[model samples]
Target: MQLILASKSPRRQELLTLMGVDFKVVLKDVDESYPQNLSPAEVAVFIAEKKARAFDEKIEENAIVLTADTIVCVDGLILGKPEGEEHAFEMLSLLSGRKHEVITGVALLQNQKIHSFYEISEVYFKSLEAADIRKYIEDCKPFDKAGAYGIQEWPGLVAIERINGSYTNVVGLPTHRVYQELQKLK
Candidate 1:
Protein backbone atom coordinates (compact mmCIF):
# COMPACT_ATOMS: atom_id res chain seq x y z
CA MET A 1 0.00 0.00 0.00
CA GLN A 2 1.17 3.55 -0.67
CA LEU A 3 1.21 6.29 1.96
CA ILE A 4 0.62 10.00 1.48
CA LEU A 5 2.10 12.66 3.73
CA ALA A 6 -0.36 15.57 3.76
CA SER A 7 2.02 18.29 4.75
CA LYS A 8 4.94 20.37 3.50
CA SER A 9 7.06 20.12 6.64
CA PRO A 10 10.56 18.89 5.80
CA ARG A 11 11.09 17.49 9.30
CA ARG A 12 8.03 15.26 9.15
CA GLN A 13 9.07 14.04 5.72
CA GLU A 14 12.60 13.29 6.94
CA LEU A 15 11.37 11.33 9.94
CA LEU A 16 9.01 9.23 7.83
CA THR A 17 11.80 8.63 5.33
CA LEU A 18 14.19 7.54 8.13
CA MET A 19 11.72 4.82 9.06
CA GLY A 20 11.82 3.47 5.51
CA VAL A 21 8.20 4.26 4.84
CA ASP A 22 7.43 4.43 1.14
CA PHE A 23 5.46 7.63 0.94
CA LYS A 24 4.69 10.50 -1.42
CA VAL A 25 4.23 14.13 -0.39
CA VAL A 26 0.90 15.83 -1.19
CA LEU A 27 0.47 19.42 -0.14
CA LYS A 28 -2.97 20.19 1.28
CA ASP A 29 -3.77 23.74 2.26
CA VAL A 30 -6.10 23.80 5.23
CA ASP A 31 -7.06 26.51 7.64
CA GLU A 32 -5.32 25.92 11.00
CA SER A 33 -7.68 27.83 13.22
CA TYR A 34 -9.53 25.92 15.91
CA PRO A 35 -12.21 26.65 18.51
CA GLN A 36 -11.14 29.14 21.14
CA ASN A 37 -12.20 26.88 24.02
CA LEU A 38 -10.10 23.84 23.18
CA SER A 39 -6.98 23.00 25.20
CA PRO A 40 -3.61 22.76 23.55
CA ALA A 41 -3.84 19.06 22.81
CA GLU A 42 -7.37 19.40 21.54
CA VAL A 43 -6.31 22.37 19.48
CA ALA A 44 -3.57 20.35 17.84
CA VAL A 45 -5.90 17.44 17.16
CA PHE A 46 -8.55 19.73 15.75
CA ILE A 47 -6.16 21.35 13.32
CA ALA A 48 -4.72 18.01 12.31
CA GLU A 49 -8.18 16.74 11.52
CA LYS A 50 -8.88 19.89 9.56
CA LYS A 51 -5.80 19.27 7.49
CA ALA A 52 -6.90 15.70 6.89
CA ARG A 53 -10.35 16.82 5.82
CA ALA A 54 -8.88 18.13 2.60
CA PHE A 55 -7.57 14.75 1.41
CA ASP A 56 -10.98 13.32 0.50
CA GLU A 57 -10.09 13.69 -3.17
CA LYS A 58 -6.40 12.74 -3.09
CA ILE A 59 -6.81 9.49 -1.15
CA GLU A 60 -7.50 6.30 -3.00
CA GLU A 61 -9.42 3.31 -1.66
CA ASN A 62 -6.24 1.47 -0.72
CA ALA A 63 -4.08 4.52 -0.07
CA ILE A 64 -3.50 6.04 3.38
CA VAL A 65 -3.03 9.77 3.90
CA LEU A 66 -1.34 11.24 6.97
CA THR A 67 -1.67 14.70 8.52
CA ALA A 68 -0.08 16.21 11.62
CA ASP A 69 0.12 19.42 13.65
CA THR A 70 2.51 20.37 16.47
CA ILE A 71 1.88 22.84 19.26
CA VAL A 72 4.14 24.24 22.02
CA CYS A 73 2.36 25.14 25.24
CA VAL A 74 3.80 26.90 28.26
CA ASP A 75 1.59 27.51 31.28
CA GLY A 76 -1.59 27.57 29.22
CA LEU A 77 -0.76 29.63 26.18
CA ILE A 78 -0.11 28.04 22.82
CA LEU A 79 3.11 29.26 21.20
CA GLY A 80 3.05 28.78 17.45
CA LYS A 81 5.81 29.79 15.02
CA PRO A 82 7.08 33.30 15.49
CA GLU A 83 6.00 35.97 13.04
CA GLY A 84 9.35 37.76 13.06
CA GLU A 85 12.78 37.96 14.70
CA GLU A 86 11.56 40.04 17.66
CA HIS A 87 8.74 37.61 18.33
CA ALA A 88 11.17 34.72 18.24
CA PHE A 89 13.35 36.31 20.89
CA GLU A 90 10.32 37.07 23.03
CA MET A 91 9.15 33.46 22.90
CA LEU A 92 12.60 32.03 23.68
CA SER A 93 13.01 34.43 26.58
CA LEU A 94 9.71 33.38 28.11
CA LEU A 95 10.65 29.72 27.81
CA SER A 96 14.04 30.15 29.47
CA GLY A 97 14.41 28.47 32.88
CA ARG A 98 10.96 26.96 32.51
CA LYS A 99 9.25 23.76 31.58
CA HIS A 100 6.91 23.44 28.61
CA GLU A 101 4.96 20.77 26.81
CA VAL A 102 5.18 19.85 23.16
CA ILE A 103 2.08 18.25 21.67
CA THR A 104 1.79 16.63 18.24
CA GLY A 105 -1.46 15.34 16.76
CA VAL A 106 -1.56 12.92 13.84
CA ALA A 107 -4.40 11.88 11.58
CA LEU A 108 -4.28 8.84 9.33
CA LEU A 109 -6.98 8.65 6.70
CA GLN A 110 -8.24 6.23 4.09
CA ASN A 111 -11.56 5.62 2.38
CA GLN A 112 -14.26 6.03 5.07
CA LYS A 113 -11.77 5.51 7.91
CA ILE A 114 -9.83 8.03 10.00
CA HIS A 115 -7.47 7.45 12.93
CA SER A 116 -6.18 10.33 15.00
CA PHE A 117 -3.95 10.53 18.09
CA TYR A 118 -1.73 12.95 19.96
CA GLU A 119 1.57 12.78 21.92
CA ILE A 120 3.00 15.09 24.52
CA SER A 121 6.61 15.61 25.66
CA GLU A 122 7.88 17.70 28.52
CA VAL A 123 10.96 19.85 27.86
CA TYR A 124 12.90 21.98 30.31
CA PHE A 125 15.29 24.77 29.53
CA LYS A 126 18.00 26.37 31.59
CA SER A 127 18.10 30.10 32.31
CA LEU A 128 19.29 31.86 29.16
CA GLU A 129 20.72 35.36 28.98
CA ALA A 130 19.74 38.04 26.48
CA ALA A 131 23.07 37.92 24.68
CA ASP A 132 22.89 34.17 24.44
CA ILE A 133 19.39 34.35 22.99
CA ARG A 134 20.57 36.97 20.52
CA LYS A 135 23.48 34.88 19.31
CA TYR A 136 21.35 31.76 19.05
CA ILE A 137 18.67 33.63 17.14
CA GLU A 138 21.24 34.96 14.71
CA ASP A 139 22.94 31.60 14.27
CA CYS A 140 19.73 29.60 13.99
CA LYS A 141 16.69 30.71 12.02
CA PRO A 142 13.92 29.88 14.49
CA PHE A 143 11.07 31.86 12.92
CA ASP A 144 9.66 28.79 11.22
CA LYS A 145 9.35 26.56 14.29
CA ALA A 146 6.88 26.41 17.12
CA GLY A 147 8.08 28.00 20.37
CA ALA A 148 10.61 29.79 18.22
CA TYR A 149 13.04 26.89 18.71
CA GLY A 150 13.93 23.57 17.23
CA ILE A 151 15.00 20.79 19.58
CA GLN A 152 17.53 19.64 16.97
CA GLU A 153 19.23 23.01 16.65
CA TRP A 154 21.86 24.96 18.62
CA PRO A 155 19.57 26.00 21.48
CA GLY A 156 18.53 22.40 21.86
CA LEU A 157 22.20 21.45 22.12
CA VAL A 158 22.92 23.91 24.93
CA ALA A 159 19.81 25.34 26.55
CA ILE A 160 17.68 22.22 26.87
CA GLU A 161 18.35 20.57 30.21
CA ARG A 162 15.99 17.57 30.28
CA ILE A 163 13.23 15.91 28.31
CA ASN A 164 10.74 13.48 29.85
CA GLY A 165 9.21 11.98 26.74
CA SER A 166 9.84 11.15 23.09
CA TYR A 167 12.57 13.52 21.86
CA THR A 168 11.32 13.27 18.27
CA ASN A 169 8.01 14.86 19.30
CA VAL A 170 9.85 18.10 19.95
CA VAL A 171 11.50 18.02 16.55
CA GLY A 172 7.98 17.93 14.98
CA LEU A 173 6.53 14.42 15.15
CA PRO A 174 6.21 11.44 17.52
CA THR A 175 7.97 8.90 15.27
CA HIS A 176 7.64 5.83 17.52
CA ARG A 177 3.88 6.08 17.76
CA VAL A 178 3.70 6.81 14.06
CA TYR A 179 5.74 3.68 13.34
CA GLN A 180 3.50 1.48 15.47
CA GLU A 181 0.37 2.92 13.91
CA LEU A 182 1.71 2.25 10.45
CA GLN A 183 2.59 -1.34 11.35
CA LYS A 184 -0.92 -2.04 12.57
CA LEU A 185 -2.20 -1.11 9.13
CA LYS A 186 0.38 -3.26 7.39
Candidate 2:
Protein backbone atom coordinates (compact mmCIF):
# COMPACT_ATOMS: atom_id res chain seq x y z
CA MET A 1 0.00 0.00 0.00
CA GLN A 2 1.16 3.50 -0.69
CA LEU A 3 1.56 5.97 2.18
CA ILE A 4 0.43 9.52 1.59
CA LEU A 5 1.60 12.23 3.99
CA ALA A 6 -0.70 15.21 4.03
CA SER A 7 1.61 17.85 5.42
CA LYS A 8 4.30 20.21 4.22
CA SER A 9 6.55 20.09 7.28
CA PRO A 10 10.08 19.14 6.31
CA ARG A 11 10.76 17.74 9.76
CA ARG A 12 7.87 15.34 9.46
CA GLN A 13 8.90 14.34 5.98
CA GLU A 14 12.46 13.64 7.13
CA LEU A 15 11.29 11.55 10.03
CA LEU A 16 9.13 9.42 7.79
CA THR A 17 12.05 8.88 5.46
CA LEU A 18 14.24 7.87 8.38
CA MET A 19 11.63 5.29 9.27
CA GLY A 20 12.24 3.70 5.87
CA VAL A 21 8.75 4.45 4.67
CA ASP A 22 8.22 5.27 1.01
CA PHE A 23 5.55 7.94 1.06
CA LYS A 24 4.20 10.65 -1.18
CA VAL A 25 3.53 14.16 0.01
CA VAL A 26 0.07 15.54 -0.68
CA LEU A 27 -0.34 19.13 0.38
CA LYS A 28 -3.71 20.59 1.32
CA ASP A 29 -4.86 23.82 2.91
CA VAL A 30 -6.46 22.77 6.16
CA ASP A 31 -8.31 25.15 8.43
CA GLU A 32 -6.60 24.85 11.81
CA SER A 33 -9.02 26.90 13.82
CA TYR A 34 -10.87 25.03 16.56
CA PRO A 35 -13.59 25.67 19.08
CA GLN A 36 -12.58 27.64 22.17
CA ASN A 37 -13.97 24.93 24.43
CA LEU A 38 -11.49 22.29 23.33
CA SER A 39 -8.34 21.57 25.32
CA PRO A 40 -4.89 21.83 23.79
CA ALA A 41 -4.64 18.14 22.93
CA GLU A 42 -8.15 18.06 21.59
CA VAL A 43 -7.45 21.06 19.43
CA ALA A 44 -4.45 19.34 17.92
CA VAL A 45 -6.44 16.18 17.21
CA PHE A 46 -9.26 18.19 15.73
CA ILE A 47 -7.00 19.85 13.23
CA ALA A 48 -5.25 16.63 12.30
CA GLU A 49 -8.52 14.86 11.66
CA LYS A 50 -9.70 17.82 9.67
CA LYS A 51 -6.67 17.54 7.44
CA ALA A 52 -7.14 13.81 6.98
CA ARG A 53 -10.80 14.28 6.11
CA ALA A 54 -9.85 16.76 3.43
CA PHE A 55 -8.05 13.98 1.57
CA ASP A 56 -10.59 11.22 2.19
CA GLU A 57 -12.14 11.38 -1.26
CA LYS A 58 -8.83 11.93 -3.01
CA ILE A 59 -6.86 9.01 -1.57
CA GLU A 60 -6.50 5.84 -3.55
CA GLU A 61 -8.12 2.67 -2.26
CA ASN A 62 -4.79 0.97 -1.61
CA ALA A 63 -3.22 4.03 0.03
CA ILE A 64 -3.11 5.26 3.60
CA VAL A 65 -3.25 8.98 4.37
CA LEU A 66 -1.48 10.45 7.38
CA THR A 67 -2.10 13.88 8.84
CA ALA A 68 -0.80 15.52 11.99
CA ASP A 69 -0.74 18.76 13.97
CA THR A 70 1.52 19.86 16.83
CA ILE A 71 0.80 22.39 19.55
CA VAL A 72 2.72 23.77 22.53
CA CYS A 73 0.82 24.37 25.73
CA VAL A 74 1.82 26.04 28.99
CA ASP A 75 -0.34 26.94 31.97
CA GLY A 76 -3.43 25.83 30.10
CA LEU A 77 -2.78 28.09 27.12
CA ILE A 78 -1.94 27.01 23.60
CA LEU A 79 0.92 28.80 21.86
CA GLY A 80 0.75 28.24 18.12
CA LYS A 81 3.24 29.47 15.55
CA PRO A 82 4.42 32.98 16.29
CA GLU A 83 3.05 35.87 14.30
CA GLY A 84 6.40 37.63 14.10
CA GLU A 85 9.70 38.34 15.89
CA GLU A 86 8.15 40.06 18.87
CA HIS A 87 5.68 37.23 19.36
CA ALA A 88 8.48 34.74 19.15
CA PHE A 89 10.41 36.62 21.81
CA GLU A 90 7.40 36.73 24.09
CA MET A 91 6.85 32.99 23.70
CA LEU A 92 10.46 32.16 24.44
CA SER A 93 10.43 34.43 27.48
CA LEU A 94 7.38 32.67 28.82
CA LEU A 95 9.05 29.27 28.40
CA SER A 96 12.28 30.24 30.10
CA GLY A 97 13.08 28.17 33.20
CA ARG A 98 9.77 26.36 32.74
CA LYS A 99 8.35 23.09 31.58
CA HIS A 100 5.69 22.86 28.92
CA GLU A 101 3.76 20.18 27.06
CA VAL A 102 4.16 19.52 23.36
CA ILE A 103 1.32 17.57 21.87
CA THR A 104 1.11 16.12 18.37
CA GLY A 105 -2.11 14.63 17.14
CA VAL A 106 -2.01 12.17 14.26
CA ALA A 107 -4.75 10.78 12.07
CA LEU A 108 -4.46 7.85 9.70
CA LEU A 109 -7.12 7.39 7.05
CA GLN A 110 -7.44 4.21 5.00
CA ASN A 111 -10.35 2.61 3.16
CA GLN A 112 -12.50 5.51 4.30
CA LYS A 113 -11.89 4.76 7.99
CA ILE A 114 -10.05 7.24 10.19
CA HIS A 115 -7.91 6.32 13.21
CA SER A 116 -6.55 9.03 15.47
CA PHE A 117 -4.27 9.40 18.48
CA TYR A 118 -2.21 11.97 20.31
CA GLU A 119 1.22 12.04 21.93
CA ILE A 120 2.34 14.45 24.64
CA SER A 121 5.93 15.27 25.54
CA GLU A 122 7.12 17.38 28.42
CA VAL A 123 9.98 19.73 27.63
CA TYR A 124 11.92 21.66 30.26
CA PHE A 125 13.92 24.75 29.37
CA LYS A 126 16.76 26.37 31.20
CA SER A 127 16.65 29.99 32.25
CA LEU A 128 17.42 31.86 29.06
CA GLU A 129 19.06 35.25 28.99
CA ALA A 130 17.48 37.97 26.91
CA ALA A 131 20.53 38.21 24.70
CA ASP A 132 20.56 34.48 24.12
CA ILE A 133 16.88 34.51 23.23
CA ARG A 134 17.39 37.35 20.83
CA LYS A 135 20.33 35.63 19.18
CA TYR A 136 18.43 32.39 18.81
CA ILE A 137 15.49 34.19 17.29
CA GLU A 138 17.72 36.06 14.88
CA ASP A 139 19.61 32.96 13.90
CA CYS A 140 16.76 30.46 13.74
CA LYS A 141 13.84 32.62 12.58
CA PRO A 142 11.42 30.21 14.22
CA PHE A 143 8.38 32.10 12.98
CA ASP A 144 6.93 28.85 11.59
CA LYS A 145 7.23 26.82 14.79
CA ALA A 146 4.93 26.45 17.72
CA GLY A 147 5.76 28.29 20.91
CA ALA A 148 8.18 30.17 18.70
CA TYR A 149 10.77 27.40 18.96
CA GLY A 150 11.90 24.16 17.42
CA ILE A 151 13.22 21.60 19.87
CA GLN A 152 15.78 20.45 17.33
CA GLU A 153 17.11 23.85 16.36
CA TRP A 154 19.57 26.35 17.86
CA PRO A 155 17.14 27.36 20.59
CA GLY A 156 16.69 23.68 21.44
CA LEU A 157 20.42 23.10 21.63
CA VAL A 158 21.00 26.02 23.99
CA ALA A 159 17.77 26.17 25.95
CA ILE A 160 16.27 22.70 26.35
CA GLU A 161 17.21 21.15 29.67
CA ARG A 162 15.37 17.84 29.26
CA ILE A 163 12.35 16.07 27.86
CA ASN A 164 10.15 13.39 29.49
CA GLY A 165 8.46 11.81 26.50
CA SER A 166 9.10 11.04 22.83
CA TYR A 167 11.76 13.46 21.58
CA THR A 168 10.43 13.06 18.06
CA ASN A 169 7.05 14.17 19.34
CA VAL A 170 8.57 17.56 20.08
CA VAL A 171 10.03 17.54 16.59
CA GLY A 172 6.48 17.53 15.10
CA LEU A 173 5.85 13.77 14.61
CA PRO A 174 5.81 11.00 17.20
CA THR A 175 7.87 8.54 15.22
CA HIS A 176 7.79 5.56 17.56
CA ARG A 177 4.02 5.73 17.86
CA VAL A 178 3.65 6.27 14.17
CA TYR A 179 5.63 3.16 13.34
CA GLN A 180 3.56 1.08 15.70
CA GLU A 181 0.31 2.34 14.25
CA LEU A 182 1.48 1.76 10.72
CA GLN A 183 2.31 -1.82 11.64
CA LYS A 184 -1.27 -2.39 12.70
CA LEU A 185 -2.40 -1.56 9.20
CA LYS A 186 -0.03 -4.06 7.67
By lDDT, who's the top model here?
A: 2
Alpha-carbon shift of residue 60 in model 2 (angstroms): 0.7
Name the lDDT value of residue 30 in candidate 1: 86
Against the reference, the lDDT scores of all candidates come to 0.90, 0.94
lDDT (tens digit, per residue) of candidate 1 on 108-153:
8878577899999999999999999988888887888999999888
Q: How far is candidate 1 from the true structure (C-alpha RMSD, Å)?
A: 1.0
Task: Determine which window of 10 residues in candidate 1 has minimal summed lDDT.
Answer: 53-62
For candidate 2, the per-residue lDDT at 176 reads 99
Candidate 2 matches the true fold with a TM-score of 0.98
Residue 173 lDDT in model 1?
86
Per-residue CA lDDT of candidate 2, range 1-186, in tens? 899999999999999999999999989997888999999999999999999999888878968999999999999999999999899999999999999999999999999899999999999999999998998889889988999999888767878989999999999999999999999997
Clash pairs, model 2 backbone: none
